[model samples]
Target: MAQVEITINSKNYRIACEDGQESRIASLAAMVDSHVKDLVEQIGQIGDTRLLVMASLLIADELVDLREIEREVSSEGGAAVPGDGEEKIVSALNAMAGRIESIADQLERA
Candidate 1:
């Protein structure tokens, strides 16, 4: 295992991961940081732990919203073929949900 240092909500974290997983860890950190930044920008200077918790909740809400939209679209046969805009949106939403799940799992483990 290797240690990766990441900064989120202006605080640094040292997380352990297997070798060759540095990029993935960094990517996860970036996402968290982005969320935290958004929260900070909106609310202006909250406690780090509270900000992190709020960020997680916001991310989870986003995932749930996307899943609902995906279900509705699928039920309505919105994406009927490849190359169509609806198909692309559905695909993107699926990928995003997968990423969000992975991030949530990681956060839970952390």
Candidate 2:
């Protein structure tokens, strides 16, 4: 395992990941940090725990919206897609949402 240092809301967290997945972990950390930063800018500094909860909710809400859109698309027949890469984009979005959910779960336990 390799340890990756991720900064979110200016706080550092050291997490372990597979050696080759350091970059991937960092990218996800960046995503979370971006959400936190946006919230901080819009609402000002609320405690770390509250900020993280809000960020998690924002990410989870996006996930729910994506899932709903995916179901609507599937039910309407995927052949009616708008563009060529829509399917790929949806798949990637869902995968990212799953990862976000996993991260949220880990945070809850922490």
Candidate 3:
């Protein structure tokens, strides 16, 4: 296992990942950080937990869009079929959303 320190909304978090997945995890974290920052810009710093939940929803929306596109392409029998990367992205986004929601639930209970 490997630990990666990621910064989102000026706060740092230590995340553990498989040894070879450190870079992939870092990349995902960067994407998440960008979303959080963009959300902050649009809505101001409402709250970290709210910002994170909103960001997760926004990313999940993108995943939903991608899945819709994939479905349309498949229905049309288009040559430009979505690849494994899209599947991986959808999977990652789903997992991330689940984790974020879980954290939010825990925060609310505390």
Candidate 4:
């Protein structure tokens, strides 16, 4: 285990994590600090305990939303990202429309 020093809301914290994972820990801490800083700016120096609790809740909410999306995508056989395969559909439709136009042109010429 290695200890990483992280600063959140101007306060320093020493956290332990797997060896060589210090960067990951610091990155995650920065995200939490950003949330805490935003909370402080909006709500003003709420007690540390309250700030931590609220931040934790906010992160949890994000995780829940992400999990829900993953579940929905998995249940549909596989993830169907927004606009995935859209280009192919559009290409096929355009080709059909072009063929129809060509037929119409031929009819007019005849």
Candidate 5:
């Protein structure tokens, strides 16, 4: 295991993860921090625990919406066929979904 230092709301946290996952862990922390910051800006400070809960819900909703959009696009044959942009777009979307799932898992554990 390796330790990664992540910052949220300007506070630093040292989290442990499998080796070579430092970048992923840092990305996860940045996502959470961004969400929390947005929430705070929109509604004003509401305590750490409450803000974190709200941010988690908001992030979850975003992930669900993205997944739904991806499903719709796939059903409509929007994915690119051999040697086309559609294939690249589809691949990118799949990668995003995987990343979102990883962030969600991190939020849940936090």
Candidate 6:
């Protein structure tokens, strides 16, 4: 496993991933960080945990929209293959959502 350092809401986290997926992880982290920053600007620095949850929900919403698009395209008999980057994005978003949910669960327990 490769450990990648990522920053979200100005806080740093070290995340482990596949050895060759470091850059991909960084890119995904950047997306999440960007969302978190945008949420902070709009809502103020409410809390790191809340900002993260909001960011995750925002990204998950995007993922849902993408899936709907893909479904429509497929239903329309379009030849566009969604397995290119969209599938990867959907998978990444799902993983992030799981992680966020786990964190939220831990926070609730605490």
TM-score per candidate: 0.66, 0.71, 0.70, 0.71, 0.69, 0.70
- What lDDT is obtained when candidate 6 is compared to the true structure? 0.75
- Please report, in order, the local distance difference test score of every candidate based on alpha carbons: 0.75, 0.78, 0.75, 0.71, 0.75, 0.75
Which candidate ranks first by TM-score, i.e. highest? 2
What would the per-residue lDDT of candidate 6 be over residues 1-110, giving only the tens digit for each residue? 79999888778899999899999999999999998876666556778888888788878877776787667667768746646556656675686666656645554564
- Scored by lDDT, model 3 comes in at 0.75
What is the overall TM-score of model 2 with all chains considered together? 0.71
After superposing all C-alphas onto the true structure, candidate 4 shows an RMSD in angstroms of 19.6
Q: By lDDT, is 3 or 5 better? A: 3
lDDT of 3 by residue, 1-110 (tens): 79998889999999999888888988998999998886666557779898888788878877776777567666767635457556656676686666656745654564
Please give, for residues 30-102, the per-residue lDDT of candidate 5 as tens digits: 9999988866665566688877887787678667766775786677687545455556456666775566556
Error of 1 at 17 (Å): 1.7
Model 4 segments beyond 4 Å from truth?
84-110
4 against 6, candidate with superior lDDT: 6
Best by lDDT: 2
Instruction: State the displacement of the C-alpha of residue 38, model 4, in Å, after optimal TM-score superposition.
Output: 1.2
Model 5 clash pairs? 80-86, 80-87
1-110, model 2: which lDDT tens digit per residue?
Answer: 89999999999999999999999999999998998887676556778998888788878877776777677778878748567347656676777657656755655565
